[model samples]
Target: MNRKDKIALERYRKRLEFARSSGEVNAFETKAEQKARIERAKKDYAYMCKEYFPHYATSEPADCHLKAAKQTMKNPTIKKFDEMPRGFGKSVMDDILIPFWLWINDQAHYMVLVTVSKDRASELLEDLRAEFEGNPKIIHDFGEQHGHGQWEKGFFITKSGFVAKALGAGQSVRGLRVKSRRPDYIVVDDLETKELIKNPKRQDEYVKWIERDLIPTMDGDIRRFVYANNRFAPVMIQTKLQEKHPEWVVNHIKAYDPVTYKPTWHQKYHDNYYRELEKDIGTLALEAEYLQNPQVEGYYFKPEHIQYGKMPKLNQFKIIIGTWDVAYAGSATSDYNAIDVKGLHDKNFWVIDTFVKRCKMVTAVSYMCDFQKRLPKTVVVHWRFEAQFWNDEVERVIRETERQYGIKLNILKIQVPKIKKMDRILTLHPYYQNGRIFYNEKLKSHNDTQVGIAQLLSIEPNYKTNDDYPDTQQTGIALLEPYNTQNDGLNYRQGKMRPKNERI
Candidate 1:
């Protein structure tokens, strides 16, 4: 039968079934009644398709180059495509691809389109509506008045199936669900932000949403789309899903790649701009933006700027203090504590050595004992430990170790005034700038220590992280800041005094 004939027959069968269920028809029904029933059935079927499968009107195979690449269906269980950066074609893919497929196939299909924000999702849907309304073929085939929702427009049909909705990142996307069998397509487009991509916590949250909410909604037949800018996240949702489901066909398109797989003219333009930027701004900013390389460490605060090459052999300063920021215990969940030993050498304060460890209290005490053995016998003064978070057991262990080793340990029970973490780091900047403070070369070895320090100085006040080392360093600096004033007039104790006349 021809397409029109098949449509008419299907409409008649639906009407007859409805009439039987409704008890509105007898074996002696009039010809006019039978005709009206068929017309109503046809209209109902058209309405159902319009509501749930509006994308069918906008999305056609010929419109998207990426969709054309994956038109064949051996399993219909998997669908995948990768499209490079073009104009607004990516938005077209988001709006139309799955809806068009479902419309022509006339199957019960579920679709989800996700982006980085709700506004983006709505924008795509609006574009889809515009495309559908403008297409004469779709209006002629599916009828013009088939869509709904003034704020959130969607096409629905009563019988053929339902087209669920689109969503963006966050809690809004997590709540999307369909009562239907399985979603026909799930599209995630640029779901991560720059800050979130750099954050481990946010990245993990995104992954959890996929595993808990997204994966359960899939069935034997699933079409998934992931489109995003390549940012360096430890484990993004796209990366995690690809790892878990190896059968998934993955496609990656860099911003620079042409539609035809060669480098685009825009890429060449970007290259030229980057070269000019490199010449003008130097290497640091160019590498960060264009090449996506990690910024050079110590660019903002160079270690050498605060380095004191060598101090006088003779002790000319009176006060000597070593401060400890003790850690409770070492675990993967928490950061290790940092201890900085500072002393006045030749009237200048120097941070000679730093101790960093993620160890039990006894192990840390033993490490400190070993450290004490290397210090100059006469210059060694008070070893101050911050006892704020130190439990009784750890404190006892520390006391026992100091007594056994014959070392004088001063446990400072002072409560630090609460301030923003980053603000505490900035408090040390003045000393660093004025050459009153110096750090040993070993400061760089602590993981992300400098980054945390820079972030503490530059980031907004509310920013937080596992930044114990920088905090410890700041505490020591705060304690020492007053010493510069207290010891201003004190006579320099020339211990083991080198003969002034010996130089002559």
Candidate 2:
């Protein structure tokens, strides 16, 4: 069918369904039962959420969600900014449940929903509209809710005299009112996009807009201004607000603890699920979206530092080592298995190949074994990973691969240095800066190589995201340490050694 027909059909069906809803009287809860429910909902936001929208609020609310709800509801004059991990239903709680909760309790007479754009705001408004117009529980509890204003575009008013308007960022929002009751409750959701974060001027403009224009639109002594979004970058509006207004209630919560790799909502997220997600979306994205730590851009290390050129002959290399940086978790930690095969010649470190992936131990072990088989029998490779990661799991994977391939790898555990990771990764900067490191030009476009290079370039002091690639590369250089030393032939700075006794 055409677009108009489909839309008309949808509207007609909604009307028919609304007409049929009364016949589903058996499905509706009794007035007293609903009254009791409303009382309970007034007291607890989470309960109202699950009871009203069973389809959306599937699992028990996480502490972050509950905390956000409490913070939003407890203070009527709250100017709160919540930074929740994406996919954790920040919108459902901030935009819909809490606002509806206030309306139901007669706490808010006018509400405003602001998003990144007017269209986006309208979409969220539609969700609230769906609950009002079609939700049986809402209809049963609050009589009918749709009416009082044009539900066109981005404006709506319930029959019970609650006003709501959706607006985009940077739009004029001063002097908004509904019969002497201006917007007492305002929610700003997903106002920072990836593009907006890149422009510092734009980010500053947004923060300015919120502080100067949008928040001023609300009336009365008791006003609610909520800004909810998962921080997408280091210098977004949320961070700007955090710096300027430390007094505002800032509820910053990640989907999982970065150190323990524990999910905030333990009942919903698990290790296996995160593993698949890490594989599907990559570590950088997971760190940003799920872990609330966006990837750090390189300050010391630059892309130009990595030179792609012709590799020297293998026979010309003084020493070769295939270094591995292993993580304990199969998929949980912000660690990937990085296998960097490197060679040193004439003070230059040549990165021959790389195997970087967030995968099972068996997969990384299999790659090591396969790569070993491809090398000529004359070439000997010294395989090494950190001695700290020497465990039954790593041993079992290597032994099983040995059995499968009928070939033993000359793998050994290397002692980890007492130095910090950030310091060690930075040690490679001089080599890169001096034009002494050559990446195999043929592997320049390879996924593993590119990913490894990206990590290398992302190195800076106290970087929180993955660093396994550069860690392995630096370890490989350490392994070839013996090849790097030079003998200084008899330079006579001590020709004065005899002069010391003479001077005395």
Candidate 3:
């Protein structure tokens, strides 16, 4: 069938179904019933939205949040932010529907839509053009448009004197004007990317532009701003904007209902559907994308979010080493002496064993000696410790422990610079995100491992707790990096200096 025939059939089916459900024909409808429907549509923004764009909205909920958004946008002094998950019609609402509605109602005459790239911004404008040209519902309600000659890719001028323009981030938006009108509303959509946020300097630059350039382009104090994005990172531009200006009203719509693990909008993304996606992408990525939790905060070590499973056998490991974060006295309040037996098999970084203690120096040395003696006979375990924390007395104890244990400890004293503790722990965060870190299942039972897990989960900037486990794990991972590129399996080479130095 042709498109027109199909549309006719679909409408006929809907009408017939409605008649059967209500036990009444539309031809016999009461005047009161028709009046109520008309009055309700006039009052409801979501109702009006669907009435205008019925084809784009299927399984329409009672509330699509357009009503609330419209009310919020009515207050010009209120800067608005809506963080909706992917595929939730964020662009349709912010880039097209809200702006178009505001324009037709004479709420605003000039609007700007900014995105990550100029091409994306232009495409958003093209959507508006398509709607204006061909949307029968809009044309029937608002009359035919007379802006055909003025419509273009990046900017358009409606015959009613409403102007819409598209611009990318970092582009010059100063003194933006069309005739005597300046932008009355600005809609920023996903202006951040992983690449853009990676550099601290670049992030600051973007923020400066948003504050110094974008906001100032408005004609008066009664300008409305709408920012739409998913919660990609805690340091994202929207997050920063909210921090600087606490008055901004922010709304975050998560894809899934956290308690039920079901999709919030089941018609689009169902529970079982996203559970499969969660499995494929892993929990960390899924949480960031759908749950609106990036698992990144001030303290970067997220041990709770780290992927863990049964580790391979000791023999299967290509490299195994016990790396240390040493303390001198190990007093009750002093830093705990810590060591982690770490190994690498395939792409997985494994923490096979952990030892952390608040005891005398001799006791700490004994734990290290015992850890060396317990390793597999076939495994040539390399030993590394912070040399700055050791002295002639500690070195003498290590030599005697080797003689007594009859095990040659391939020990290396790494003189690492005094870096800030928090910075050191965060170096492992990327590996955790990539699902590369695993811990021995039994390690959870040990107090030191428990301490490590606690620190990992609760870590933040200016972390107050002892981070012995995370610090030692960092050392162990650093030692394993050299072998990460080699193909001939675990090669025992001299340990190199750690890559990043912490600020003292």
Candidate 4:
């Protein structure tokens, strides 16, 4: 016999011996009984998955998401995207359980699983082989049954004539035929990596592969596409899929609620546990993996966008002002009162310093007075605050502070505009993007500026806590509106608009 034939014969013998040793060969049950039991389980995907993967069985209602996604994949024409958060068991379900279900139910003729890398793809295939060949639950029900000579890493076949292969992202998947049948279902899991999403060009290429090459590999009209991933970036394959086909059934299950911050599954992951994760990885990373909302650097505020260098001398600018966003509640957990001190010269604006602290209303007022006293007397400081919530109380504090400090104060009480906070925040995005805003290096050590920048980059329309820092910063930027040539009505003062000469 030829060498290849000899190797194949020896491999088959080894598999048969292994199966016999593992008690996979059923001696008592008839073929009809085994077939009947599998058919019964096939009617319910959750039961079949539980029966095979008993260790993963959970009472959490979120598991229902998996079952629903499986049903979506059962159709031949329906394409699906399951962008579940990390630790949601998406990869476990897609790589192993769903494929097993399709094979046993005779719903799919051939399937291919793709992952970020060829090594990871092969590892997932190896995991599938372990369950097929050694899992006691599957073996006990189905008996010693596997395709005799078609089992290997990265490629495998079931005794029921189901063909499975594993390939890496962007790998050659065309002309993939098993037993004269083209791939009927494609399961993609974790196809994005940090490096891939960091580059827009690479992201475009990935989208092309999915649109031009990957989806067309399906053999039949009634084919299925199951794409699952944790959104490490806002621009990912799942994001692309959702944009391309809004009609597809997309299940975006976050690990926790955005408002309550409660874990979807309390038994396994609690809010406290996620807080620890947030502390370890920072807010941006936690938002990406746990919340399934990636905060791309430079999407809103980028470190590179702001020109960072030595702070200009406070007296060098024509005007210096401070903008305040006060916390009316004055509770221990309320927003900190932030006073952003800014200097404006010609067209450039420099953040001279910052005074941010969490305190009661009286103490916050005292802190602002102390900050003003420390600045040079020649540098005119104008203060503006949101007065809609507690205007009377804030005015009283301003009067009390001026009386105690014995210094005239120019304060602007802006009636907070009736617009979305994000809409106002977005107005300052251009200044950041154009390198018009400069920050003092000392702000990082003296103030919570680093944390504030992170908060700004991660801010979303529905974001809960981060609006304060960016809101204050945006107010500081708004101080330049009088100098902007675009605001024809407001630019009457031209060069450096002085604060109204009034005593608080």
lDDT of 1 at 287: 31
What clash pairs does model 3 have? 299-460
Backbone clashes per model, in order? 14, 0, 1, 2
Q: What is the lDDT of residue 33 in candidate 1?
A: 64
Off by over 4 Å in 1: 1-221, 225-308, 311-317, 403-408, 441-460, 485-504
* Per-model lDDT: 0.50, 0.78, 0.71, 0.69
Which digits, one per residue and each the tens of the lDDT, describe model 3 over residues 297-372?
Answer: 3355554555557879998988998887777765435676778888989866898887776655566667767876
Q: Give the winner by TM-score.
A: 2
How far out, in Å, is residue 271 in model 3? 4.0
Q: Write the residue-wise lDDT of candidate 4 on 292-313 in tens digits.
A: 6555464566667656668777
Candidate 2 lDDT score at position 471: 93
60-83 in candidate 1: lDDT tens per residue?
Answer: 222223333334223355534343
Residue 335, candidate 1: alpha-carbon lDDT? 53
In candidate 4 the C-alpha lDDT for residue 165 amounts to 85
What is the lDDT, from 0 to 100, of the residue 202 in candidate 1? Answer: 74
lDDT of 1 at 216: 58
Best-to-worst TM-score order: 2, 4, 3, 1
Off by over 4 Å in 2: 1-30, 256-263, 269-271, 304-317, 321-341, 345-347, 352-427, 433-435, 438-455, 460-504
Supply the TM-score for candidate 4. 0.64
